[model samples]
Target: MSSSTSTSTSTSTDDETSSPARRRSPLRALFGRGSLDIQSTLLVMLLAVSFLAAIVIGSVGYVNGRDSLRAAAFDQVTSIRESRARDVERTLAGVQQAVVLDSRNDSALQASLDFNAGFAALDEQSIDPARQQAVTAYYEDTFVPRLDEATGSSTDPSLLEPTSPAQAYLQSLYTVPFDDDFDASLAFDAADDGSAWSQARSDHHDYFREMVDQLGYEDVLLLDLDGDVVYSAFSGVDLGTNVEDGPYSRTPLADVWATALESNTVDSSFTTDFEPYAPSLGVPTAWIASPVGSGADVSGVLAVQVPTETIDSVMTGDEGWADQGLGRTGEAYLAGPDETMRSTSRELIEHPDTFAADVVDHGTPTDVAQRQVATGSSVLLQPVATTAVEAALQGRTATTVNTDYLGHEVLAAYAPIDVEGLNWVVVAKVDTAEAFAPVDVFTRNLLLSTAAIIVVVSLLSLLLAQVFVRPVRRLQHAVNRVSGGEIGVEVPVKGHDEFSELGGAFNDMSRSLKVKQDLIDEQRRENDRLLRTLMPEAMAKRYKEGEETIAEDHTDVAVVYADVAGFDDFSRGMRSGERLALLDGLWRSFDEAAERLGVEKVRSSQQGYLASCGLTVPRIDNARRVVDFTLELEGILERFNATNSSRVALRAGIDTGQVTSGLVGRTSMVYDMWGDAVTLAHRVQDVSSQAGIYATERVVQKIGDGVPAVDSGTVTTQSGEQRVFRLERPAA
Candidate 1:
C-alpha cells in the first residue's frame, strides 16, 4: 500500500510538471527563472523526493530494528536471569532445609553430645608438648602455604595455630599427619590414633563427610553450646578451637556461629554471605547454620559450608553460555550486597588475560585481577560496581543497557535473588557489541544504501523520471524488507543499468547477512562440541539437553582408596624428573590394572588413587572384581619396585555399598563418587598401619572364599563396629 501511494504521488507530480513551461513557472515562483534551469529544476525535484523517502524509510527501519534487537536482548537475559535467580533461591532453600534437618536429627544431637564429651575429656588431660608443637608446625609449614596459594596473602603462620591444648591435640592426630594430603584428613577418621577424641570423630565423622559429599558441601562443622568447634568434617585447623574467641576468632564462621546461638528455635537458620574464610586458606566461603537441639534451649550449632561450585554451575549454566542462550560474551553471576561477585566470572574462565586487562581498565587494581586469576575464582574478588548491581541490591528489578563491571556496554537483566537470610542479586548480561551486532550491520547498510539512492536519483532524474521510477520503487520495497530483518531478500534484475547494479549490490548485502547468521549458528555448534571435549559424550549430551544437575545413585558399587607407602621418603632422595617419572609409572600401572579388571578409575593424585566398580557400569560381582583389581595393583607395584630398585608398597582399602556419583565443577568438570562405600574404604585404608589390602565385612561376604583374607581388627564407626579383613596373595 505504501509503495502504491509513493509511486502514484511521484507519477502525479511528474505528469503535472512534464512541460518545461509548467516546470519553469514553479521554479520561477520558488526562486527566479534564471536561478534554476529546467534540467536543474528536474534534478532538484527528484533529489527532494529520493532524499525524503530515504530519510523516512531509513529512520523507521533503524528505529524498528534497534528496538527489536533491544527487546530480544532484554528477553534473552531476563529469561536466564530469572532462571538463575530461581535456581539460586532453590539451592539456598535446599541448604537451609539440610541445615535445619540435620540440626534436629538424632545424629547431630548424638554427635554434639559425643564430641562435647570428647572435648571436655581432652581439656581435663594434658597433651604431649611434642605433639602440640607438631600441630603448630603443621599450620606454619603446611596449612599456610596452601592458604597463601588460595588467597594470595602472606598470613602469619604463628597466628593460625590453635591456642587451646585440646585443639592442638586433635589437630596433631587429624591434620598434622596428613599434611601432604589435605583432602585425606577428612577421610582418615579411623587414624589408628589412641585418643578418645579420635574415637569420637571416627564414630560420627562419616555421617558429616557423607553429607558433604552427597550434598556437595565444602565442609560441615559441629559447635558445642559453649561455641567450641568440637567437630569438623574436613578436620581443618578449626576443629577443637572455640569459635567464640580463638585463632579464627574474627572470621565469618564465628559470626555465623554466634548467630545460630541466638536463634530461639531449632528450625531457625542463618546464612552468611561469601567471605574469605581463614581456616579454608582464605578461599571464598559462605555458611548456613542452625541450632542443634529439639527446642529453644539449643545444644550446639550445625553449619555447612555452602558449595560455591554449585552456585557457579547454576549461574554460569555450567560454563555453557551459548547453551544457555547467552552468546559468547554473555554470563549470569551473583552480586552480594557488598557489590562483589558471588559466583565465577565467564571471562575469568574463558579468557583470564582478557578478564584481567578489562577489569584493570575499569578501575580495578591490577593486583586484584592478578589475585582473582591466581585463585581461579571471582567470588568476593571481582567488584561489580555497575548500575544494575546498585539497583538490584536496592531490591529493584529491571533490564537495561549499561556499563558492566569490565566497563563494556551490556544489556543486563538484574533482580534480587529471593533467598531468605541472603542479600544477593542475580545479573545476567551480554555485551551490546554482540547482542546488537545484527542491528549495527543493518544500520550501516541502510545509511550507505540511502546515500547511494540519493546520488543515483540526482543523475537519473534529468534523463526521464517515469523511465527509472519503477526500478527505484522496487529497490525501496526490497530495502524495506531487509530493514525489517528479512535477510536474503533479493530485488529482481532487468537490464544491466545502474538500477540493476544497485539491485545486484542489495543481493550481495543480503547474502552477506545470511552468511554471518550461519557463522553465528556454526559458532554455537562449535561451543557444544567444545563441551563434549571436556566430558564424556553421554554426559555432555545430557548437559546439552538441559539437565541442570547430573547425578546418579548406584545401589551396589565397590570403591577403593589406595596410597603408595614410603613414596614420600622414596621420592625425597630422587631428582624432580625421576620423582615424577616414578609417580607417573606407578599411576600408569594402576590405571592399566583398573582397565584390565573392569574397574573404573575415578581419580588419581600423587597422594592417593581412587577407583570404583559398578559405578559407571553395573556388575553383580563388583566387590570381587575390585578385590582382584587391588591384587593386580599389588603385583604391578611389585614389578615397579623391582624395575626401580625401590621398596614402595601399596596400602589399599575396598568396600561395597551404595554410592552416588556426579559431575562436580563447571569450568573443569570432574566425575566423582561419594557415599558410605567411599567413606568406609578410605577409613578402613587409614585404620591399619601395615602396607596391605584391607576389605570391609561387606566386601568380605561378597567375595566369599574367592580371595584369601585374614581378619583385620574391627574399627569403631558411626555404624557400630565394622569388621575389616586383610586380603592375602594366593598360595601359588
Candidate 2:
C-alpha cells in the first residue's frame, strides 16, 4: 500500500509539470481558451460572406436599374421626337398639296385674269387721288408702327406701300376700312365699289378666305404674271405691289415669286423658310407658292402663308405636354438651321419666369426672353444651339444625355425633320433630375433593403452556424476514418436539412464505394478479354502496361489468309441487312473453328479473314493447325451455301516464315502482321484463279503429309522464285 501511494504521487507531479508546456504549445496557442471556437468561427465566416453577397447584389441591381431607366427615358424621348418630326412633315406636305391644287383650278385662273384687267381699268378710270393718299397714310401711321413693334425693327412705311394708283384705290376700300381689325378684313367680301376687280373680289374672295380658315393658312394672295399683287385675301400693305422690284423685294416671298416665275409650270411649287415679315404685324412666316395655270398657260403665282400655331399644336400635343407622355419639364420643339426655334417653347407657355431665368442663365440675352414673352411665342425667338441640335442639323439621328438650351442636363432625342425645303431639326427633351427620379428612389430603397438583409442574415447565420457545424464535425470524423483506409464509414443522419441530406449522401457514397470496387474488378477483366481478342495475349499485356510501341519478330509462324471467292457476286443479290447478318454469322463460325483448331484470328474484313498459328502460343505443328483451319473454313462456307443458297467458295493461302506483328493505331489500335511471309501469302492467295487453298513452300514443307497438296504456281520474291501449292483436305 505504501508503494502504490508513492507511484500515484510521482505521476501526479509529472502531469502538473507538463501542463504548462501543453498550454504554451503552438496548437494550444492557436485555439486557446480565449480564442473563437469552431461554431463562432463558422458564424463569423458566414456573416462576412453574406454581407459581401448582399453588397454585390445590391450594387448590381442598382446599376442594372439605373441603366434600364436611362434606356427607357431615352426611348420615350426618341419616340416623341420622331413622332413630332413626322407630324411636321405631314403638315407641310398637306399645305403644299392644297396650294398646288388650288392654283391649278378654274376659279384661281379667272380671278387672276379679272384682278389684272380690273386693276388696269382702274388706272384709266381717274379714281380719287385723296383716297390713294389715305392708303399711304394708313401704312405710315397704323401698319409700320405695329410692324416695328412686332418685328423690333425701324421700317419706313413707304417701303411696304402700294406703288400704283390702282393698288391705292383697291386698298382704300378693302384694307383702310378695317385698319382697326386687320384679320377681319379678309372676310369683308360684300363690297359694292362698282369696279370689276371689286366685283371679282366679291366673287372669289370668300372662297379663298374659306380655304385659309379650313387649311390653317395665315393668308392667301394672287399675283399677276408681272409680280403684281392684284388680289389679297387679307388686303394687307402688300396689296398691288410688284414682288420683283417692290420695297419688300428682299423677302422670302420675293424669292418664291422669282422661283415660281422661273419654273413657269403649274405643278411646280416653291417653299421658303421662316422669316420675319413686315405684313401680319411682323409675325414669323413661311410661304408656299405655286403657278396659277397649267403648263405653258401660267398666268400668275399663288402664295399661302404657313400657320405657326398649327405646327406648334402638333409638336406640343396641342399644349397638353403631359398627355403626350412627356411629364413635367419635358418639351418637343423644332430648331432651324439658324439655331432658332420653329415650334413654340413649352416653358415660355407654361412657366415664363422660369424660361426667362433659364435662358438668361444659359447665355441668352435678357431682352430676347422679354421679346419672346411679349409675343407670347418662341418661334424665331428661342435659340437652341445644343449638341443634339447641331448633330441633327448635320443629318444624324441620335438619343443622348446632354446640356440643353437652358444649360440643364437633359435626356434629349433629336432628328432632322424630313420637309422638302426646311432645314429643321426636331428635339424632344426632359430634365435629367425628373427622368431619373425613379432610379433615385430605387437606389434608396435598395440600400435600405440591403441593410435589412444583412441584419436578418446576421441573426440567422448565428443560429445556422450551430446547426451546420454539428453535421460538419460528424462528417469530418467519418471522412478521417475513410482517409485512414477504413472505407464504408457512415455518419448518423438527423433532421431533413441540407446537412441531413449531406450525411445521407455520405453514407450512400460509402456503400456505393464497396459495390463500385467489385464492379471495377469485373470491368478490368472484361477490358482484358476484349484486348486479348483484338491482339495476341503477350501484346495485349504489354499494351495494358502502357507500352508506347509494341512489335515482335517471330522466326517460325504460320499465317493463313482466306476469303469468299464469289462473295461479291453472291452478296450482290442480297439486301444490305441480309448480307451483313450472314457475314456476322459466318465470321462467328470461322472464329469458333479457329479456336478449335488452335489458331488465333488477327483481324477480319468484309472481304477476307486472316489468322496466325504459333504467333501468340507456340505449337510444334503450327502449319498443320493453319492448314486444318483453312479446310474448316471451306466446310463452313459449304454449309452456308447449302443453307442460304450462296455460291461462295473459300480461297485461302498459307505461309510459314519470319514476320513482325504489333498493335498498329493510336486511338483504335489493331494487331496486324507484316513481312515477306505476309506479303507472299497475300500474293499467292490472289494468284489462284480457282477456289482452293494455296500454300507457300515453307508452309507445305512444315505441314508435310498432314495435308495433301499439288504444285500450283510460282510467286516472284526479292530472294528468288518461291513455289506455291494447292493444298486439299486429307481425304475429308
Candidate 3:
C-alpha cells in the first residue's frame, strides 16, 4: 500500500513539472531567447531602418524624379519637332519660290499653258469630222464600259448629259492608251533616266537628274495642272499615270496636288507628310508642290522631294541624338496624319543586331523588322498610338505615363507640330524601368542591407512551409500542363487561404483559356469559310495578298441563276423574320444540294441564288454537273412543298460558256460573273415566270450525255435573241 501511494505521488509531481507554466510563451520564445535571439533582434532593427527608411526616402524621390524626367523628355521632343517643322517649311517654301520664278521667266510652262488653252477651245463642231467620230467611238466603247464596271451597273446614254461640266470633266480624266500627255511625260522621263532615243530629250533628262542630285533631292517632277506627271527625274514608271484616274490617286502625293490646285495663284503651294510612295516601291516619302505660273496663267506643278533622312536627323538632333538629352531608352519620333512613324528611332539605328527582338517585344511585325535589319534599313515604319500622340494629333499638347506603339510602358510627352498642309504629332518617351532606375537601385540596396534578418524569416518560413508547399506544388504542375496546352486540368483546392484562392484562380483561368481557345478556332474556321463563300478561294487568297484588282477568265464555266418566282408577293403577307427564315432555309437546302453535287454556290439573297461550275478550279464535266444539280433542285422544291403547307415556287436558268468573274466593293465583297453565258442565264430566269426552267443553247451542247432537255426556241431581250432549251423531266 505504501509503494502504490509513492508511485502516484511521483506521477503527479512529473505532470506538474511538464505543465504549460513550464514552457516559454509565444512572445518570450521569440524576444527572450539567448544568443540566436539577440542576433535576430538586432537584424530586425536593421531591417526596419533599411526597408522602412528606404520606403520613406524613395517614394518622395520617385515622385519628383518622375515628373522632372517626363517634363524634360517632353520638352526635348517638342523642341526637336519644332526644329524639324521649320526645316520642312523652309524646304517646301524654296520649291514654291523656284516655281514662281519659273512661271514668270521660263518657256516650258508657257508652252504647256498654250497647249491646254488650244485643246479646251475646240468643241465637237470645231474638230475634224474624222477626229470627232474617233472621239465618240472611243467614249462609247471604252469610257462607257469602264464607267459601268466601276459603278457595277449599266445606265442609259440619254441619262448622261455630255455637255454637263461634271460629265465632260470625267471624260477628259480618262487615260487614252497613248494620249499626248502620257506620251510627252514618258519621253521626258525616259530622257531623265538616260533611256531616251532623241538626243535633245536625252540632254534634258541628264539635266533633270543632275539637277536633282545637285539639289540634294530624291526626285524632281513636273506635273500638268490636269494632274499628269509630265517629267520625272527617276523613270517612266509613274510618268504615264494620270493622278485623277490611275491607282496613284489613292496616295497622299495626289492629295498634295489637289491642295496646290485649289488656288489659281503661283503662291499656292503645298507639302505632304511622309507616306509610302507606291511608284517608288512603297518607301517613306514626302513631297512639296508649287504652281508653275501666277494668277489665271497657272498651268502645272513643279514638285521636289526631301529624303526622310533629313527629317530624321532634325528629330534626333545633330550628331546622332547625343545632344538630344534622351537616356538609354528615351527617343523622339514623328507620327504623321496616318499615325505612322515618320522618323527613325535612335536605338534601332545604333543596335541593328537586336532590332528584331526589341521590335517583337514592342508588338511590331518582327518579320518586317528582321528583313529591314538584314538590309540595314531604318525603323521608320512603326506606328505610335498612345494617348499623348492622340492628343497631339488633335492639336493638344499633353504629357502622360502610357503605352507606346512598341507596347512598352513609357513616360510620354507629345505635341502637334505647327506646319502648313500637314497633320503630324511629335512624341518623346522613356521606358518606365529606365525612368525609375534610381528607385530600383534604392530598393535593391535596402534589401541587401536587411539580409541579416534571414535567420528569423527562415524560422517563420519553416513553420508555414508545410501549409503552403503542397498547394503551390500542385499549382505549378497545373501551370505546366496549361503551358503545354492541356487546359482541362484543375488544381485541388485546400483550406481557404491565399494559396487556396490562388488554386481557385488557376482553375478559373484554365476554363477561361479553354473557352477562348475554342472561340479563336471557331472564328478562324468561320473566317476561312466566309471568305471562300464570298469569292473563289483563289481570288480570296489574292485579295488577302493585297491584290487590288481580282478578276479571272473562265473559258468554259457553267453559270446558274435561280430565284423565288413569287417571292415579293409571298413575303408581303409574312413577318420579316418569317420571310428571312424562308430564304435562309431555301438557301441552306440549296447549299446542301450544291455540296452533294459539287457545284459552287457563290451568292444567295432574297432576290436569287447565283452559282457556278468550273469558275475557280477547272472541271471538264462542269456542264453536266450543273445540269444534275438543277434536276435535284427541282426535286428539293417538290420535297419543300410536301413539307410546308404554303407553296413556294422557283424559276431557274442555266448556261455554259466563257465568262469573266471579279469581286466588287472594298468593305463587303461580292463575287460576280459577266459574259453572254451569264447574261443569257439571268435574262432567261427573269422572263420565265411560268416556264419553270430554261437552258441556253450553250448548256445543251455542254450538258454531256445523261442530262435531259427539250428544244425551247429563241428568247428576245436587250442583248438580242438567245436560243435556249427547256429543262424537262426525263422518262423513267
Highest TM-score: give the candidate number.
2
Pairs of residues at least 3 apart in sequence or in different chains that clash in candidate 1: none
Worst 10 residues of 2 by lDDT: 1-10
Error of 1 at 411 (Å): 2.4
Which sections of candidate 3 miss by over 4 Å?
Answer: 1-211, 366-381, 436-732
**Backbone clashes (count) for model 3:** 3
In order of listing, the candidates' clash counts read 0, 0, 3
- How high is the CA lDDT of each candidate model? 0.82, 0.83, 0.63
TM-score of each: 0.55, 0.61, 0.40
Residue lDDT tens for model 2, 245-361: 887788898889889888868886788888887777778899999999877898889999886887888989988889888999899999999999998888889987688888989
TM-score: model 3 vs. ground truth? 0.40
Flag the better candidate by lDDT, 1 or 2: 2
Looking at model 2, residue 293 earns an lDDT score of 85
Model 2: CA > 4 A from native: 1-35, 469-732
lDDT of 2: 0.83
